[model samples]
Target: MGSEPGAGWEFARAAAVHSEVWVITRPRFEPLIAHALAAEPVLAPWIHPVYVDLPDWCLRLKKHHRDVYWYYPLWQRLAGQRALDLHREAPFDVAHHVTFASDWMPCGLTALPPTVPLVWGPVGGASYVPVPLLRWLGLRGAAAELARRTVTGACRRAIADRTARRAQLVVGLNDDVRRRFAGTAAVVVEPNAVVDPAARGSSGSSAPSRVRTAVFVGRLVSWKGTRLAVKALSHPAAANWKLEFIGAGPDQRWLEAEAARRGISDRVTCRGQLPREAVLAALDAADAMLFPSLHDSAPWVVAEACAAGLPVICVDLGGPPIFVRGTADGVSRVVDVGPGLPARLAVALRDSESVQRPTPSDRWSSARMPALLEAWYGQAAQFRAGRDAAGNGSSVSSEVGGLVPQTP
Candidate 1:
């Protein structure tokens, strides 16, 4: 499953462990949900999925990537109405908005009864590629970044502000997002990527080799910093590392050509897109993960890499740094984004050999999520109770309690 669906499924499973969860999602996922529930019959009674979608005509608008901006909000509006009806039938203690985890996007669930506290997020999207680093992105990628910033800025002011104000608790996916919602809501830093304990790698399973290997597991897009990785690999400091690209995109040809031009074609391999199992197998065989996404809110690959006991070397801009923060000393390297990003990354790559593999007890493990969810839900319920006791007419405060401090 992709990050969005995977996050929804994980959150639903975790939430269901404590109380009944009614997941409002697209109708297409119903079959998958049914299949998953059938496989885990014990969770069937706890999970009640409510499918809500727009008409076929409206859904067609989402055929293209850009059209999703229009389609998602409409879907949220419809889902909000459905949630209202469900709440009327049987009142809910707390409501959480999980998927479509961008903070700039408006959540229609804010329309729920004022008495019922809402937990918004594991949300992100506030992270951006620094201005000094924009030179790395080609003309088209730079233009896209500009357009994204413009849209996000407008939406944050017009939509996100209101939603944050109304939410009793806002679960930010990264420090960037937590800072964005700092005074606007009761914010907590918690990533949506949770590693399955059973899938965690055993110690020495991915033992070091004479020639170190670094794996990149996202799309081969310019904004994803694949070109940057290639440039970093060209540096003498990282000459011993062989880089493998495990995804396919428009930049694949460019990456191959660039690697050849840089005279490191022998050390670089662009292995187009692979299956999940194949990706995991590749991680098992590699020494480290290099994911320098320009402005990703959260990339599931980072958490998966950590689970595989691979040290991660990522740009210090988004969710990757947060995910790797809890790893043992030298287990992860967060390169700062600036004029010499490639050089910094090259040095980090060279140093990765001495790093330790992350254990299953790290913060990203799924085992820790149940307790976190329980605490968050309890906080939301308490916030609601306090508000009710103060009287329904009492205005909601921008700050509630249970704010988790971010590690420096």
Candidate 2:
């Protein structure tokens, strides 16, 4: 029901724990995904692989780098509705979107039925938390800043007004989203929950090597600003800074050329496209993570690095910054030196003191992540059920019980 992207696999694997996951995807991934799901005990048995019927060469159309991601989900949801309609012709308990209230879920992307409750986690850039600091740091131009403020304000105001006039159930992930549409919808801010701490405990330590190496794992595009990190190494402060980029994208060749142009051919290493396991292994020996993403929704990589006990140097975006507190314990610092990226990086390079000895939090471990997600889903169900019973249009009781406070 979702695009055959890596994150879709993440959601399907997680949701498969509570519900049978019947995934509709391209024939290309049928065998590969079936194998992966079969290995995971919680995800295997209920995994149903449904073939995508297309109007001849739809896969070919998708092979073009110019393809838009929204197209496939839109087309597939339309097809899924026909199938779900047939299935419900008999009887069923419920059908869920399993994400947020998106126009792109298996049901909503096509007008299947508002009858089936759909949930969407707005992990996309649309719901991105705007950061004024990024603008100050020279991340966005004045035009971009004005556009963001104007567009976001206008759209949010319109949505807020519409939500107020309607009697509907909605849950906001944070106070910002809740307050944005406050008067319009009775939004509930079920703040993020931490899952596992005890299991996270102390991780295996990575010995410091003479070389100060950092790893950046994500798509290699112009906006990611990964080149800025490499260029920063040229600054005397970080004369010995080494980098490894492990992701595939359109701008791979361009980046290699850029590195050469900057005469940092040796400092930066580009390993375009490695398996996820290999990428995690790559993160193991690295000292820090450099993530300068231009567009991010919930940048779990920030939290993931924290859990791995790795310090990170990244542009201060609102969502990822939530988990990052500028200290040795979590994030080193969140700076608004986007255009000053080179200057700041040079400063970090020169100042050996910039690399602080971290006091890692057990909360940021992978062990807690599962528990966190589980607890969130539990609240999601309860919130929905409570609102469902509140005469069609109601807010979750402010006094309503919440998900597990802390997972052991």
Candidate 3:
């Protein structure tokens, strides 16, 4: 598992439960892992950093110095081939994978040493649509409809292609992503983890804002559909709303400029990147969340919003709808941007859920996430054991590697 800021947190948390965990982090983030563990009691002993020489999309931080993305297939193709060799040399139990920003993936799993099985963990999360883009394009009627269809198709294709390759058993965070891989993979639209609402200070409200506050958190990229959100503030219905954004990425400069142009600069506030807890706290104060993504899987933000009971304004695009129920109550209109988008959003926001958002984790029915993942893990291990017993060279090892221990 290549180390990432988010992945570091996930791996460390999971390690506390699963004793047989080994972490392979890119060389650049070794300090980050050490620093993170030093601060968190739960992660102190279970995570370790291993150095890998080859880098590509999988290990972008280390390999990007050479600008691997500039030259596509050459480095990437070799990297995929190299992954197989590395596993063969250091054969392990099932390969567990969880990714959000997956630019590239190893093509074939069947050809790996027959002894090892590669299992998909939390596969893909949703992308944040840049709200600014929709406002810039002002796409309406046929133009917005076409754009919506293209993005919807792209999202489906992404799910289908991914499921076809790496997943033996794909765990879905929501029903929508699960539907995309329904026939191909063992789809589980269950969340892998749960949130204890009482554990946190507060989430948000289902009731519409008494104080007109909104939150948007994600990367500052084109597809996030954040542009549309900013423009929405300038719209007649949302004139009173004040928004706080918590995130940073490539398009920060451009997005800020767009907000200023729309004459809602004072209403829109960009908080840059805040800690995870801080972002949640911001959500707790706001009346609703605005997630206008074009293409995405199941967005954790949406789950977080729903779990918090904060009404959300999400396009009925791929991932957003996974958590968004509809505009009826406690949720946004699930707006689909087309001819009538701005007009629809205008009307919907007026009747938006104004009640306190009930914490879904505390009061809702079962999504059955943990059980589904545990089942997938067991099946993956069993498959690996069978392969190794048959003397397949690529088998996940029968014996466990002694728990590597160190200070947190």
Under the 3 Å rule for N, CA and C atoms, how many clashes does model 1 have? 0
Ranking by TM-score: 1, 3, 2
In terms of lDDT, the poorest run of 10 residues in model 3 is: 399-408
Runs off by more than 4 Å, candidate 2? 1-6, 19-28, 40-52, 83-95, 98-115, 127-209, 248-264, 275-278, 299-304, 322-328, 337-339, 345-408
Off by more than 4 A, model 3: 1-4, 8-12, 35-49, 55-91, 100-104, 107-111, 125-166, 172-184, 190-211, 248-266, 270-278, 303-309, 325-329, 360-372, 382-408
User: TM-scores of all models?
Assistant: 0.92, 0.64, 0.66
Tens digits of per-residue lDDT for model 1, 153-262: 89999999999998888999899998888989999998888776436454333345677888999889988889899999999989879999999999999899999999
1-408 per-residue lDDT for model 3 (tens digits): 222345434533554455444554335557766776687756555444543444355444534544543432333334334445655565545555443223233223334554555554444443333453344433452365456556645754654465345455665655554665667666655443333333454634443435477788888665676666776777878875777788997667766898788787888888999987787778777777877776665566766666665778877766567566621345455886676565566456555644445554442222343344456667766765665567756533344321111111
In angstroms, give how far residue 400 of model 2 lies from its true place.
Answer: 24
For model 2 the local lDDT of residue 79 reads 48
lDDT of 1 at 269: 99
Task: Note the clash tally of each candidate.
Answer: 0, 14, 35
Reference-based lDDT, residue 38, model 2: 69
In Å, residue 89's CA in model 3 sits off its true spot by: 7.3
